[model samples]
Each structure stands twice: as structure tokens, then as C-alpha cells.
Target: MQWSIITIGKPGHPWVKDALDLYWKRLRHYARFDHVVIKEGPLDKVEQQIQAVCGKDPCIVLDERGRSLRSVEMANWIEREEVSGRKRVCLVIGGADGHSPGFRDKAQVCWSLSHLTLQHDIALIVLAEQIYRAYTIMRGEPYHRE
Candidate 1:
């Protein structure tokens, strides 16, 4: 299945792009990967932009209030999605104010990286690495050591 990370606003820190590039390259070896940025704006407009881009793919919206999963559990969840015939899946990182009520309600999964709110650029980087980690776990690679 194709994996996409849809985020609101671009990475502000210069090195954040390079940091994500490393994970993106590693992740591409395991699954198709795509990154889409929704221009930052009013909550409703951003929600619309994210929704239009997400289309029919099951979305995992990142929020502080969401469910937390271990790295291995995330891998299993992704595996199930593929076996269940999902063609694409997106992990969405919303803007500073977070997603609208409608967007939050419709998301198939609401994921939390941490209890503390993270800087947007840092959140993107962490999300990318987690995706890569999940893939490695799926393959039983040495990259993920218990």
C-alpha cells in the first residue's frame, strides 16, 4: 500500500527537510511514500485542503489527545490495513491549533506521538522516523531492537 504523510504548513527548519529525507529514502525501499503539505490557513480552510488531498484514504490524524501505540503495534496495524485491501493510508500532522472537529471526527485513526505538543517541524520529523521504524519492524529487520 502507498503511504502518504499529509501535513499543514511546510517545514520551517532547514535541517528538518534533510532529516526527513533520510527516513523517506529508507521507507521507500519498503513501501511507496508520498508527502503533501496543506498550506497553513484558517482552521476550516486547512481542514478542507487536507480532506481534499486525503480523498478516500484512511487517515491517521496526529493529535495530543489521540491513542498511543507502540512501534511494533503500529507495524501490525499497517500490515492489517494492507491485508484488508486499503490502497493508500495517510498520517496527518495538523497545524498549531490542530484539526477541526469535523476532521477529527472523520479520521479513521487519531494518533498521538506524545502527550506534549511538539513543534510542527519536529513533529514531522518524528512522524517520518516512526513510519520508517514501523516498516523495519514489519520486516523483522535489525534496525528495530527491543
Candidate 2:
């Protein structure tokens, strides 16, 4: 299965870029994964940029108040999606001010990394790393420890 990550704006810090690239490469080794970066702007503009990628594929939009899942749970969810004949999965990360109102309502799944507010750059890294961890867990790899 292929995973498409839609993130608003580019990495703010140099290290963030390096970290996401590392995880991006690692994820590709396990499954087809790629990132789509939309131009960042005010809430309205970013939301407009986001709408272009919303397609028939299932989308999991990240927010601070969405459902929380453990790494194992995420792995199981991915497995279930694949078994259900999902060809591609979309994960969306909003801009600096977060997603515009009602934007997340369109998602098939709404996820939150944590209750604490995360900067968009850090959120990108965390999302990428967690995805890598999820894939490792699915493959029974040692990269993820219980």
C-alpha cells in the first residue's frame, strides 16, 4: 500500500528537514510513502491549498483534539485498512494555526498526536517517525519496542 502525507509548508528548522528525510527514507523501505507540501499561509489560504489533495482515498487529518492511538493500535489499523482493500492512505497536517474550522470534518479519520500543541515542523517530524514506527511494528521489526 502507498501512504501519502500532506503537510503544509516546509520544515522550519534544518534538523527537522534532516529528521523527516531520514524517516521518509526508512518508510520507503517498508512501503511506498511520499510527502506533498502545500504552500503555507493564513488559515483560509492554507485551507484552500489543502482542499486540492482531498480525494476519494481515506484521509486522517491531524488535530489537537482527535482520537489518540498507541503504536500497536496504529499498526493494527493499517493492517485492517490494507485487508479491506485500501490502495492508498492520506495523512494531513495542517498549517501553523492548525486546520481551518470544518476542515477536519471531511476526514475519514481524525487523529491527534497529543493534547499538547505541537509546532507544525515538530508535528511533521513526529508524524513521520511514528509512521515509521508503525510500519516497523507491522513487519515485526526490532525498531519498535513494546
Candidate 3:
């Protein structure tokens, strides 16, 4: 299956960008992965851009009010999607103001990385790393531990 992460704006922090790149590289062995960037703009515009990128693909939105899943659960969810022939999945990460109610409502699944609020850049990095961790767990690699 293919996976896409659509986010608002370019990654700003050098460290976060580098870390996310590292994870993206690692993820290549598991699935086709794309890191899509939507230019930062007004809330409605950004939301539109994100939605346009997502199209009708199965989507997972990152929001504070979303469900929290463990790494294993994430891996299982991805596996299930693949098994079910849902070949493409897009994960949306909102900009500074976060997602609109409509955007969240449209997602097939909404995931919360943490209860504590995180900057968009940091959340992007964390999402990348968690994806890598989930894949490693699936592959029986030692990258993640209980």
C-alpha cells in the first residue's frame, strides 16, 4: 500500500526535517511513502489544500481530540488497510490553528499523537518516527521496545 502525509507549510526546524527524512528513508522498505507539502496560508485555504491533496483516499487526521493508539495498534491498522485492498492512505496534519471541524469529520480515522499539544513541525517528525517504529515492530526489528 502507499502512504502519504499531507501537511501545511514546509518543515521549518532543521532538526525535525532531518529526523523525518531519516524515518521516511527507513519507511521505503515497507511501502511507497510521500511527504506532501501544502503552502501555509489562511485557515480555509490551507484546509482546502489539504483536502485537495487527500482527495477520496482513506484519511487519518491528526487532531487533539482523535483516538490514541499504541504502536502495535497502528501497525495492525495499516496491515488491515492493506489486507482490505485500501491501497492508498493519506494522513493529514493541520497547520498552526489545527484542523477544522469539517476536516476532522471527513477523516476515516483521527489519531492523536499526544494529549499535550505539539507544534506542527514537531508533530510531523513524531508522526514519521512513529510510522517507522510501527513498521519495525511489524518486521520484528528491534527499533521499538515495550
Candidate 4:
């Protein structure tokens, strides 16, 4: 299955961009990956932009109030999606004010990286790394150590 990470706004921080590049490169070996950025804007506009890209794929929103999963659990979840015949999975990371009520309600999965709120750029970076780690774990690689 293909994976798409759709985020609002671009990563302005050098560190965030660097980390994204690193992990994205690592994740490339495992599955098809797509990174999409919607121009920063109001919640409704951003949600529309995200939805346009999502098409029929299951959308997973990243929000502080969402369910928290361990790294291994995330891997299993992705694996299950593939087994269940999902062709693509879109992970949406909203802007500064978080997701709109409509977006949250329609998302197939709402995943939280942590209880603490994170800057958008940092959240993107962390998401990239976790995705890479998850793939490594699934492949029985030594990259992830319990």
C-alpha cells in the first residue's frame, strides 16, 4: 500500500526539513511515500485542500486528542491496512489551530503523537521518523530496539 503524509504549511525550520529528508529517504525502501503540503490558511480551506488530495483513501488525522499508539502498534496497524486491501493511506497533520470538527469526524483514524502539543514542523519530523521506524520494525531490521 502507498502512504501519503499531508500537512498544512511547509517546514521552515532547517532541522525539521533535514529530519524529514532523512527519514523519508529511509522509508523509501519500504513503500511508496508521498508528502503533500497545503498552503497555510484557515481551518476550512486547509481541510478542503487536504480532502482534495485524499480522494478515496482512508484519511488519518493527527491531533492531540487522538488515540496514542506505540511504535510497534503503528507498524501492525499499517500492516493490517495493507492486508485489508487499502491501496493508499493518507495521514493528515493539521495547522497551528489543529483540525476542524468535520475533518476529525470523517477521519478513519485519529492518531496522537503525544499528549503535549508540538510545533507543526516538529510534528512532521517526528511523524516521518516514526513511519521509518515502523517500516524497519516490520522488516525485522535492527533500527528499532525495544
Candidate 5:
């Protein structure tokens, strides 16, 4: 199974890029993991950017209004989805103002990282780490446990 993260804006900070790269490297060992950085623009334009990257794949948009899940649960969810033969899973992170209601409605699923607002750069790091953690847990590694 392949997994890709599509972000609305470029990651500007060196530290954020480094952290995101670390997780991407780690996740590559288990599955195809990559990130697509979309150009920052108007909300409609950003949505168009995301749409182009996502294509027709199953997309999970990260939003504050999305469902919250435990790490183990998320791991299981990914495993099930992959086992069911899904070609790809696209995770999207919106811009500073967040996603439009139309985008939210169009997403297959909306995932929430936390209640507090997170910078786009920081959110990318957190999302990468979670994907790594989810894979590790699915593989029965000690990275996550009940």
C-alpha cells in the first residue's frame, strides 16, 4: 500500500523540514511514504492544488473538526484499509486558515491531531510522526502499546 501526505503550504523552517524528513525516511522502510508541497495561495486555489495532487484517490483531510482516534486505533484503521486493497491513501493538511467547508465535505475522512491550533510546519512533523507510529504499531513493534 502507498501513503502520501499533501500539504497546502511549503514547510519553511529548517527544523520542521528535518523532522518531517526523518519520519519519511523511517516510514519508507515499511511502505511508500512521500509528501507533496502545494503552493500557498487563495483558499480556492489551495483546494485546487490539493485536488490536482489527490486525483481520485481516497483522501483523508486533517482538520480540527475531524474525528479523534488513539494511536492503536489509527494503526488498525490503516491496516484494515490496506488489507482491503486500497491503492493509495492521501492525507491532506490545509493552509493557515484551515480547509473550506466544501473540502471538508468532500474528504473521505477528516482526521484531527489535537484541539490546539498547530502551525502548518509543526502539523506536518506531527502527522509524519503519527504515520510512523501507526506503521510500527501495526507491525507489532513496541513503539506503541495499550
Candidate 6:
């Protein structure tokens, strides 16, 4: 399955970029994956930017208001989604100010990283790493286990 993350805003922090890149490279071995940065703008503009890049496909938006899942549960959820034969799975991350209500309404599923707030850049890195972890767990790799 092809998986991609389309976020609203460029990753400016050098450390966040580096960390995201590191996990992204590691994930490539497991699936077809890509990380895209949408130029920062107004909420509607940014949502439009993400929508344009995402195209028509199944997408799970990442938002604090979304459902929270354990790592194992997330791994299984991804596996199920891929098995369902979806062409693409787009993970959307909002800008620094967070997602607009309209954008949230459009998502097929909304996911939460944590209850605590996270910076947009840091959230990108965290999301990337969690995806990598989920794949590893699905493959029965030692990376994740209950």
C-alpha cells in the first residue's frame, strides 16, 4: 500500500527535519511512503493546499481531538486498512495553530497523538517514528511488542 503524510507547513527546525528524515528513510524499506510539506498559510488556504496534494483517497487526519490508540492497535489498524485494498492512505497534520473544524469533518478518520499539545514540527517527527514502529510491530520485528 502507498502511504504518505501531507502536513500544512514546512519543517523549519533543523533537528525535527533531521529526525523525521531518519525515520522516513527507515520506513521506506517497509512500504511506499513519502512526507510532503505544504506551505504555511491561513487555515482555509492550508486545508486547500493539503487537499490538493492528497487527491481523492482514504485519509486519516491527525488531531488532538481525534481518537487515541495504543501502538499495537495502531499497527493492526494500518494493517487492516491496507488489506482493504485502498490505493493510498494519507495522514494529514495541521499547522501550528491546529486543524480547522471543516478539515476535521472531511477526514475518514481522525487520530490523536496525545492529549498534550505538540509543536507542528515535533509532531511530524513523532508521527513518522510511530508509523515506522507500527510497521515493525506488524512484521513481528522486535521493535514493538506488548
Each prediction's RMSD over C-alphas, in Å, is 1.0, 1.4, 1.1, 1.0, 1.0, 1.2
lDDT for each residue of candidate 3 in 17-132, tens digit (9 for 90 to 100)? 78887888888998999989988888888888777887888889998899999999998887788889987899988888899888799789999999888888988989988888
Model 5 quality (TM-score): 0.95
The ten-residue window of minimal lDDT in model 2 covers 46-55
Question: Model 6, which residues run further than 4 Å from truth?
Answer: none
User: Taking the tens digit of each residue's C-alpha lDDT, what string does model 5 give over 1-146?
Assistant: 88888887789888887897788889888889778888888899889888888899988999878998888888899999989999889999888879999999999999899877778888888888888999999888888767
Cα lDDT tens digits for candidate 1, 31-92: 89888988888998888888888888788899988998899998999899889988998889
**Model 2, which residues run further than 4 Å from truth?**
none
TM-scores, each model vs. reference: 0.96, 0.92, 0.95, 0.95, 0.95, 0.94
Count clashing residue pairs per candidate.
0, 0, 0, 0, 0, 0
Question: Which residue pairs in model 6 clash with each other?
Answer: none
Each model's lDDT: 0.87, 0.84, 0.88, 0.88, 0.87, 0.85
Among residues 3 or more apart in sequence or in different chains, the pairs in candidate 2 whose N, CA or C atoms overlap within 3 Å are: none
lDDT, candidate 3, residue 124? 91
lDDT of 6 at 24: 75
**Candidate 5, residue 44: lDDT:** 92
lDDT of 2 at 95: 78
Error of 4 at 4 (Å): 1.2
Badly placed stretches (over 4 Å) of model 5 are: none
Best by lDDT: 4
When summed lDDT is taken over every stretch of 10 residues in candidate 6, the lowest stretch is: 8-17
